[model samples]
Target: MRTLTELLTITKNGRGRLVLVSAEEFFRLKSRDRRAVQPAELSDAELDLIAKAGMPVECAALDAEMKGYAL
Candidate 1:
């Protein structure tokens, strides 16, 4: 079980090969399904930075057909 930072480190370069989701997206998915495979927890600092960067995160990228699964 790696932390969010660790997971980010692993996926950072493979961004084109992996999904990069925001913390909000992660939680919204989680609430919809108890079994949803939400992304790792991001630090508040990171979240704040993202918000400050003027990029509003949208979970709309999530596939509706994609069911919940453990990460």
Candidate 2:
């Protein structure tokens, strides 16, 4: 089996280096996070801040379109 480092694709961007991984690997890494927080447990201020935050216009448009494909 290939090492994680060997399987990754690294690229340079203006901000910093970005690492690309397969969607399977991405979800595998995400699932390993044991410190996930419940939104309901957040304070009112935190919840308000989250609710007030806006997605980028491009992302908002894409999100609207993606709603149609949701299971």
lDDT agreement with native, every candidate: 0.58, 0.75
User: On residues 1-71, what C-alpha lDDT tens digit does candidate 1 reach at each position?
Assistant: 54443323235564545655567667767788755333357677866886788423575456454668656
Instruction: Give the RMSD in angstroms, all C-alphas superposed, for model 2.
Output: 12.0
Q: Please, what are the lDDT tens digits per residue for candidate 2 over residues 1-71?
A: 66553455465675447677667778888999878589988899999999899888777667767876957
What TM-score would every model get versus the actual structure? 0.25, 0.38
lDDT of 2: 0.75
lDDT of 1: 0.58
Off by over 4 Å in 1: 1-16, 34-71
Off by over 4 Å in 2: 1-34, 64-67
Residue 16, candidate 1: C-alpha displacement in angstroms: 4.9
